[model samples]
Target: MAVLDIKNLNVAYKSRNEKVFAVDNVSLSISEGDSVGIVGESGSGKSTLAMAILRLLSENDTEITGEIDFKGKDLLKMDINEFNKIRWKELAVVFQKSMNALSPIHKIGSQLEDIYRVHEPKIAKQKLKEKILSLFKLVNLSDRVYNLYPHELSGGMLQRVSIALSLIHKPPLLILDEATTALDVVTQGQILSEIQKLEQDIKMTRIMITHDMSVVANSCKKVVVMYAGKIMEVGNVEDVLIKPTHPYTQGLMKSFPTLKGEKKELSGIKGFLPNMSEKNKGCIFAPRCSFVQEVCHKVAPKEFEIKSGHLSACHLHGSEIN
Candidate 1:
């Protein structure tokens, strides 16, 4: 069964003059224990989609339409009080900037204690400490980190703490928005490995938002390719990330350098993203597509099933790519 079902979710930042579309008509269903990665360059609405699901976006300037159904409840329509109860307990997020996410003034253990107490208030102090310490060990943190302030810990350590805190609640759905972006390449790999290890025992669905295809390759089973605020492809990582069907997904794969196999010069997709504030009738990636059809510039393409479990939004299909 699906743990989360998002139907035609549209998120736009509105101003007095115009509305900038960040996510438009995007629909996805995430099943339990699925490790899905949403990959795209900056401004592709990957983070925006995560924020919308978490209800972190400010309603004053941001207009969010459609449903964010989480475990049978509509998160978007849920009351703020009720949603707060569900946020970290059932669904949690670990952001890239770990330093900013944590409290600098308080020691790590105390801060974690406060968070745990909010949701699980009746627990004894000794039991809470034991739980926090156990979580630290799970994320591979040192016992010394409990007394250290946020600034005292290294960036990697801080991120580990953040991960531990998120996992403390044992949330069913964990949305990690660029969680490994700010770390060094080696540190990123270590963190990713740690996350994967956690999965073996956690039994939780994970959504990894990143621009790195390799990250998806290393961690996720399924991949969602986003460009210009829309999903270009969605399928198993082997089908979508390895053998991409959409031109944009193909471009993304080409742009990145591969560590193994035949070494070749990287190819970049030429052309900037279309303005989000302006209205466009065509596929937003048409300007940069190498195999663009004439209709691609004139009409928006609906998602067509490319394989048994793969889908793409392009006039062209996978067979025509070769």
Candidate 2:
């Protein structure tokens, strides 16, 4: 069975008497031990989907209707108390800024110990120390850095600490929301290598949320392309990245610089994402698509099977179906 399955998920926030849609009618699935990348331009609803899965969005002001099934259980239906039990133990997240995620006032050891003790309260002091030390080593951190303040560490070191913290409870699913965005290129490469090695060792499922296509190419086996709150394409990483069928996906690939092959000037996609407050009557990307047809501006396209395990939502790909 797939480890995570989202069905007909929709997320909208109440804003000035109107509901602004951030994620709309999206569905996806990830199997155990699969590394999936969610990639899109800014305002493409990638982060919103992550927040929805984690139940971090404000309930009172947000309308979220969906089935977020994790391991056969609907996370969307779970109560706060019940969900809390699974938050860090079964599912953990490493946000964008590592420094902000860490407490500025506390020592690294204390903060890590606090998190560890919450899940294993009865663990003796010596055993806990050993566990923390092992984790630090796993992330290639020295023992001396344990009692240091957050500001004492470099950006790369702090990111490693964040990764260590996420794995402290051995959660099967780890969501990285732009976890490497703040670091230098070298540091980002190091962290990606560490993640790749760690995944091999633990066989954990990971969801890497980033706008960088190169990052996805380096780390993920599968890729999902989103645009204007809906999925545009999803398939194996190489297939989706190299042979993108959707106009939006193809445009995104053209905008990035590829390391291999002859170098060419990058071309960016034209037009901006439409305002979320406006109700979409047809294809959300119709205005920006270079291949947009009259039918595209009048009717939204249904997802069509391009090949085995590959799907694209585009009127240009095949005959439209109800």
Estimate every model's Cα lDDT from 0 to 1: 0.88, 0.88
- For residues 147-206, write the lDDT of model 1, one tens digit per residue: 989889888788878888888888999999888776678767776776676666777899
Error of 1 at 181 (Å): 2.2
TM-score for each candidate, following the candidate numbering:
0.96, 0.95
Off by over 4 Å in 2: 318-322
Q: Which ten contiguous residues of candidate 1 have the minimum total lDDT?
A: 191-200
What local lDDT does model 1 show for residue 145? 88
lDDT of 1 at 258: 88
Candidate 2 versus truth, CA RMSD in Å, comes to 2.6
Model 1 TM-score, all chains together: 0.96
Poorly placed runs, candidate 1 (over 4 Å): 184-187
Compose the digit string of candidate 2's lDDT tens values, residues 48-90.
9999999999988899998999998999999999998999899
